[model samples]
Target: MERAEMKMKVLSTVTVERTDDFYKVVDQLNRTLKDKGLTFGFALDEKDSNKITMTIYEV
Candidate 1:
């Protein structure tokens, strides 16, 4: 489905220290969501240096 067509349902917001590459984090999140049969609504990253606060939602 198109991104704009997605319907978001807030799930969880979390903060984590950067332990891996940004792209790797994204890929892992995609894989995890797919495994759970969940659509990835979107993610908001409040990035500050090495710390990232990520808000994850379901579609």
Candidate 2:
């Protein structure tokens, strides 16, 4: 079967000292997408020391 394509944008904020937290969030997001039969292309951005933004495109 062919996989469905979708586009998703996610934004998250974390303290600089807790940068690792972003990985967990990203992992969960990926899992959610996979469960929905979707693939993701991630565009990551560090808005600041306490802010981050991720844009995910399904391909």
Candidate 3:
């Protein structure tokens, strides 16, 4: 029998009124993902806005 492969993807967004808040949010997210045995990918921008986005993919 052949083993099946699975993929998981997660997206998170944070909007902050201050620059420090942005870094803090990202740091928390990284820790969360590390605890979950997940890896971080790249973020995508939708149009042009002040929102920060992140993407994660794992198998």
Candidate 4:
């Protein structure tokens, strides 16, 4: 399949209480939204492990 390049944008960055299970939700979003031009990313706050930074991107 031929794909065209699209510009990526940072939709949002949210900091919330961290949980291991959040990875499952992020994974599901990536799988379900990749073709819709949206991607979800996640990272733990380096200074505070109890917080997670969730980033949504447009692609």
Q: What shift in Å separates residue 36 of candidate 3 from its native position after superposition?
A: 1.9
Candidate 2 local lDDT, 1-59, one digit each (tens): 34355434443332333355667766887788876644433334555545445445444
lDDT of 3 at 38: 68
Report the C-alpha lDDT of model 1 over 7-54, residue by residue, as the tens digit.
Answer: 777677676675556556666777878666454332334556566666
Ranking by TM-score: 4, 1, 2, 3
lDDT of each: 0.62, 0.51, 0.52, 0.92
Q: For model 3, how does the per-residue alpha-carbon lDDT over 1-59 read when each residue is reduced to its tens digit?
A: 33265556554433333343665655675678776756554333465455445555453
RMSD of each: 3.6, 5.7, 5.7, 2.8
Residue pair clashes in candidate 3:
none
The candidate that wins on lDDT is 4
- TM for every model, in the order presented, reads 0.53, 0.40, 0.39, 0.81
Give the count of colliding residue pairs in each prediction.
0, 0, 0, 0
- Candidate 4: list runs displaced more than 4 Å: 1-7
Candidate 2, 55: how far from true, in Å? 1.0
Query: How much is the lDDT of residue 46 in candidate 4?
Result: 82
Off by over 4 Å in 2: 1-19, 35-47
> Model 3 misses residue 12 by how many Å?
7.3
Residue 48 CA displacement from its true place in model 4, Å? 1.2
